[model samples]
Target: MSSSSAPTSGTLTYDQAGVNYDLIDPLKVSAQRAAAATASHLASHGFTEVAASRGESAYVVDVGPFYIASIVECLGSKALVADEMATLTGRSWYDGIAQDTIAMAVNDLITVGATPLVVQAYWAAGGSDWFGDAQRAQSLVAGWKKACEVCNVAWGGGETPALAGIVEGGRIDLAASCTGLINPKERLSVGDRLQAGDAIVLLDSSGIHANGLSLARKLVERLPEGWLTEIDPVNHPGLTYGAALLAPTVLYSPVTEALWQAGIVPHYCANITGHGWRKLLRHPATLTYRIHTVPPVTPVLAFIQQHAQQDDREAYSTLNMGAGFALFMAPEDAQRTVEIAQGLGIGARIAGQVEAGPKQLLIEPLGIRFGDDDLQLR
Candidate 1:
């Protein structure tokens, strides 16, 4: 029998299929409201044209000729996986997840055309054993140092809490907040200069860069026996799947810096995460993104597609689909941008172009169109 007809042994509800909006909806609403309140407060305080007006990453405060942007993000469900890593690899769980925490926070700051200046982490752990405490502290500091060095940012102090009964099995929660500065003259906003035929450049991702694991985990859990034990079955090195998944999020500072040096300023930029183009369309404008090509879909993504029988739209909507950072540059600047990224040893490709539309995303070849409601932050 073909895979689709093999069997319907167990039913899969949307929730069981790994979409739990009950928990996700409240948080999403709260975040949207908080962002709106912040935007209003900033405007009331005499700031003009907050980038929050355009929804890329965070609220950008217009300070004279410059803009200061701040972004905060937690490690998300991957924290649970990092904790499991301690048991699986006999390594410190905190060390496993710390760099990832910092990466998540800083990447968003850069998405809004800011250079990260400092990063701070907030850690939570259930009654820490002596070994756990020492290891976590050591790992967090080490991770912070590494991240700071790579991104050329300062490592601000962090918070660590030992909650007695709230957390289970000595679980540790990791989160980071980042601050960056962008010259207002240099800040980029979605649709600000984005026009038809402008090139869409894609920066290759480092395997599942910190989003959509809620669904990936569910897919893994549903896999039949012997699947997990096989090496290279998922196209990624089987032995390092966990470590690769936990790989520190790539810092795009180098890419952004290179673009700045090359004098190829993008009109719009976004760090492709949780919601993909849905997040990109936060700005209220009538435009369509036509993605003509994509980077090679890594094995892990392909495996998920094959196993879950996920359609193209669902897969791209939930996962990064191999593009980590997207750049919307002038049609004339696309080649130079790709050259600059390649010079930095980063793989880059032209994924799509922008066009006049009713503010929708039309993914060609795949024949998927995301309407206004589909892009809304629910």
Candidate 2:
């Protein structure tokens, strides 16, 4: 029998699986170092790179009086989920995948306190025939445009490449990039204001928000019926496993813009996608994140945890579980931040606080502690 407990002899881990970060981490470091070396070239273009923005969610460039934030993010294999759903339910989940792609890009760009201005898409397919289906093509177009509208950004043109040999003939990879403007210059939240007494408010995610789908898809393989398996009726009734997983990601750009407009500036912000909750401490600081209360894990995530049989350490470190975006601000603004997010129709709460100490993430409720060693981005 499988159990979500300690790792025994047959336990599964992310490292043991195909997506090993150990191998990928070094490549990222090498690329970042190479990218940093070219910063001096931007100086001649009348743009200077922000000193500490090299490893941030978005790259910030100083343009005279204002700053610009830019990011490029892929939807990962989440689009594969959409493709599978199309075969099983005969309905394209590309619309949801479109929204996920936008969320993945804009959410990261906003972490630097920039308002997205222009967004572009990258749809790489194995063959041109992939877009031959009218329903899938139209759904992707409409969904991507709708998400851009929610972000209040212009839908700039994008590229659709047909690389028959590189990608599977039936599959397409979705990704996006956007540029944001940080007006007035004082609105930048790049960790300079992040201090010990600040509150950590976490915005909730709408179930598996486009991070660990590569792992989640593997979990489905171990299931009795794979994608066709029904989600727990009591928890997520009337949804197949693929449908529950394909639900559109929650858009957080509007929520952050609302908070900014309210005159509540966060000291730092992080889009909790790739690194899960540990992303709250992405900045290179010696402060500790004391999580007093952990948010309720979403039903879809709960299903993943139970079926995958992972312990808390593995699960929380690998999946967002519930928390999506994080904001570090003064204690006085914590409640109002939650209020602003909730007002924007997004769920949120004050989940933790920053403390003066060695860098670590202490989840008091779950008895889980992640040291700086556990979250090495550099």
Candidate 3:
């Protein structure tokens, strides 16, 4: 593994990398408020929007007998890493990037307790020449189909636009929209049932899982070999930084589906993405999430932490660390939730419980606390 000198002064931050939620979140809050105003318009179509789900991961609407949830999510800059990795390794990593795109959409969709039914892709290339590479194009298509099959959703077709000047040449932006069903009108989980005693079950993540990539990409500049820097010399002998970053995100829809099939309904579910552990405070309810344990950090993430010189608070606030998805449910169902996740070959554990207090998340092990001010998505 190549080595880089420690930062001369301040630690690197996500904001320094040009991804600042402080500036971005107020816009989301403003949009949500504006979006709520248009909900009443649904009445004309004989459907009622679930006002409570306005700020949830997926937007839900009641159409009499059943509820529908939908979300559109983008893959962010992770695809750029795959692009660089392809150049370094001489192998197309777009297949994993394709799955990462689908995972981003469906994971958010399932947090509303909706079973994903279909996914639509949006591939906007900088130029038509982008698709002239048959190998990369085919890998992307195959991966998208494979991910849809894994999530048990149909590939409902999509649009591929070639924007020459708008997007940088030789690059493509990937995103997807997922539509889901909340049948029987009982599976809707928008934190309405979240309370003091609900247990917090955390599922393990497969490395970074597509969040904080901008910062990760920025960190590459400090390294001598850049993307080719080996993440770890002993354990992961030949694993390049690019390979680790390109690891496909874990698709979590199956865990949600399996829990529902087993008759367990989480009070609230959060797909721990961009907000990192701070997402635990996403619910609107005024409650304290006390986490007793945290999943072990993925090796690649540890490498980033050491190189980036991020403290526990900074790291947990910006990246997933290890937990990918979180579930707040009845205390009695905590073990069952973990079992269900494990059954599906996902690592999970009862990490904490909710408490009646201020809106905050207290990670006990690291003595890290994220207050309501940390996240303002609502």
lDDT of 2: 0.87
Tens-place lDDT per residue, model 3, 1-378, is 023333444688877777656777788878877888899899999989988888788999999889999999999999889888888888899999999999999999999889999999999999999999999999999999999989999999999999999978999999999999998689999878988999999999998998999888888888788998999989999898889988899999999898888999999999999879999999888899999999999888898888889999999998999899999999999998999899889999999999999989999999998999988775
The segments of candidate 2 whose C-alpha lies over 4 angstroms from its true place after superposition are 1-10
Q: Tell me, what's the RMSD of every candidate? A: 4.5, 3.2, 2.9
For lDDT, candidate 2 versus 3, the one ahead is 3
Candidates in order have lDDT scores of 0.70, 0.87, 0.90
Query: Comparing candidate 1 with candidate 3, which one achieves the higher lDDT?
Result: 3
User: How much lDDT does candidate 3 score?
Assistant: 0.90
- The predicted structure with the larger TM-score, 1 or 2, is 2
- RMSD of model 2 against the true structure: 3.2
Candidate 3 weakest lDDT stretch, 10 residues = 1-10
- Count clashing residue pairs per candidate: 2, 0, 0
> What is the per-residue lDDT of model 2 for residues 1-378, given as tens digits with 9 covering 90 to 100?
122332333446565445767778899999989999999998899889997788888999998989988999998889988888899888788888999999999999989889999999999999999899989999999999999999999989999999999988899988999999998788887889999999999999989999888767767767778887887887666777888898888889998889878998889998888767778769999999999977788877887878778788888988898999899999999999999899888899999899999999999888999998888888
* TM-scores for every candidate against the unseen true structure: 0.86, 0.96, 0.96
**Deviating ranges (above 4 Å) for candidate 1:** 1-14, 17-19, 22-54, 93-96, 130-137, 224-228, 231-237
